[model samples]
Target: MPALDLPFSLLDRSRTRAGEPDAVAVRATVERAHRAEGLGYSRFWVAEHHAVPGIASGSPAVLAAAVAARTHRIRVGSGGVMLPNHVPLVVAEQFAVLESLYPGRIDLGLGRSLGFSAPVREALRTARTDPEKFLRDVAEVRAYLQGRGPVTARPAVAQAPPMFVLASGAGLTLAARAGLPVVVGGPVLRGPAPLAPYRAAFDDGPAAPAHPYVIVSANVMVAATRGAAEELLLPDAWAMAASRATGAYPPLEEAAAVRRRSLTPKQRESVEQFYDQAIYGSPDEVVAELADLVRRTGADEVMLTTSTYDRDELARADAAIARLFTA
Candidate 1:
């Protein structure tokens, strides 16, 4: 078998499980980050979501700081921080504090998304929806990080931590033009249209590297058998389909309980589609598929985002995936 040579990282959304308190999910994420460090995973990133019951990580910088405090060596970051929800200076200071305390082990990945829904967006006081504002905000963030603006960000460091832009299509072009690395996944990874433009637009000047950096995010689960793997994936898949059919994104239920519930025809189709697209299998099968993903997408790194009902099984899957690169 070919070695799993591409770098791999963990992206934890801090998914809340059915019947468990949200606090448990948050704490579990930090614990998982510690485990990831010991398992030889490169980076552990937390995501931000608001007005969503299923996700507890509403503040990435705060969670990243918590993870950084617990782990000795693994890089901790936002998978990323949604820029529109935050004041640029505030975002700058929060990360500056993280960098001040943790030094070289922090990453700041920024995205232009307005929270999740219109109500959430309104609650966030998102003033700008224009795409051009995203560019402006990204520039402003870079400025604040480097203390280039009239008001210097507090606890100014000698350097800004490496920055990443999470985007696709035109967003990728914007990232490349700014010389920042772009993280791509979802629909963009499923097709070939977006990446070529990203590479073509890339200049790789002093602001970023000479070559483009691509990170692919995927829903991955691994178990001793294919059936077990599918079972592990079902809870999150069901929650997603439920969210689509009705706007409520509930916490994940147990696999057995989720399987017992009958889905609407539309929801059933959504669930099956999600199951079909996810990467899951025994160790050998997963390793082959993951390598092929890297080959097809030209990903510099692979970021695994797995949500499961069973904590023990989740840890086992994490360990199994880590071994592909380590063993």
Candidate 2:
């Protein structure tokens, strides 16, 4: 509830670990999400990334249950579940069970990307299709939840919680048309351009709220020293930037190591530029920036993800951001 006052949600992973060596980090991250519920965070979302050992959120629905079991009040859902790989009925059934157990604390954020490499894509054995197919799955998901889809799956639609499309491109428009709420996924790293696209195309449909429902996810990291905060966050920013540029999932390389790697001139430039959009600074500095983000984007919420892996740091970050209003 406090995060709602500040309107910050927690984006976490259930299965994916950042640094290698395997099993330990994966479990630790899930435990971290469960513990984060005690903090003043809103929804807790796990993303769907496959074949990347570094990615722990591959089965978001399953992870949602694990997180929900451990925590009491905070909402739990997928930051995104890539919709291209599976059948609609299956998702409907799986989440149906989840919604039944957890009730109101469920969110389903869907994405259209494959979320894996070509080889991993083949291993999933899913057929690649047109973008429109993504919409069909959405419709099917909506129909099931609204209790209108076919009865063959015997899906408990009416009992299912809520679902939203997690999109980077025109996903807001599709969500707007469907009258479902949407959270603008990805770092506001691209800044207002990505945010603008989602807002410009939002439609006022039957289920539409009078105001737009936009929660821009922020890659914010704050600490005592601006340099310290940036240092803590650089690894993630560097990793994310690398993945975007190469479409190759790499381990969470140290920022310096990543910088020294075989980066083209343009790639180096991109990595530097991406940080400009993220909130990485001291508590005082971050408050000024974070407040401006909400005011500028008209985003109803901001999901903070970066170095939340450290509890003391996270508590300080929360306190600092909260001070803006209290002061």
> TM-score per candidate, in order?
0.95, 0.84
- Local error of candidate 2 at residue 16 (angstroms): 5.5
Clashing pairs in model 1, backbone N/Cα/C closer than 3 A: none
lDDT by residue (tens digit), candidate 1, 1-327 = 455886789999999998899999999999999999999899999998888989999999999999999998888999899887877888889999999999999999988877657788789998565667777777787788888966999879777877888887678888887778888777643545367778788877765667889888888888889888999999999998988965657898998998789888998998987876688998888888788778887788888998898898899999988988853
- Which ranges of candidate 2 are over 4 A from the true structure? 1-6, 14-19, 127-129, 152-159, 185-211, 244-246, 254-267, 307-327
Q: What is the TM-score (0 to 1) of candidate 1?
A: 0.95
Q: Could you tell me the C-alpha RMSD of candidate 1 in Å? A: 1.6
Query: Best by TM-score, which number?
Result: 1
Worst window of 10 by summed lDDT in candidate 1: 185-194
Q: Which candidate's lDDT is highest?
A: 1
lDDT of 2 by residue, 1-327 (tens): 122245667776532324556555456556666666656567788777777755555788887888888888888888777778778877777788888888888888777777457787888776574567787787787667667778544546455566766655666667766556677645544456456656556665644445457777777776777888777666666666667766754556555665567867776666676677678787667777777777676777777665433445555665554444321
Query: What clash pairs does model 2 have?
Result: 3-7, 15-56, 16-55, 16-56
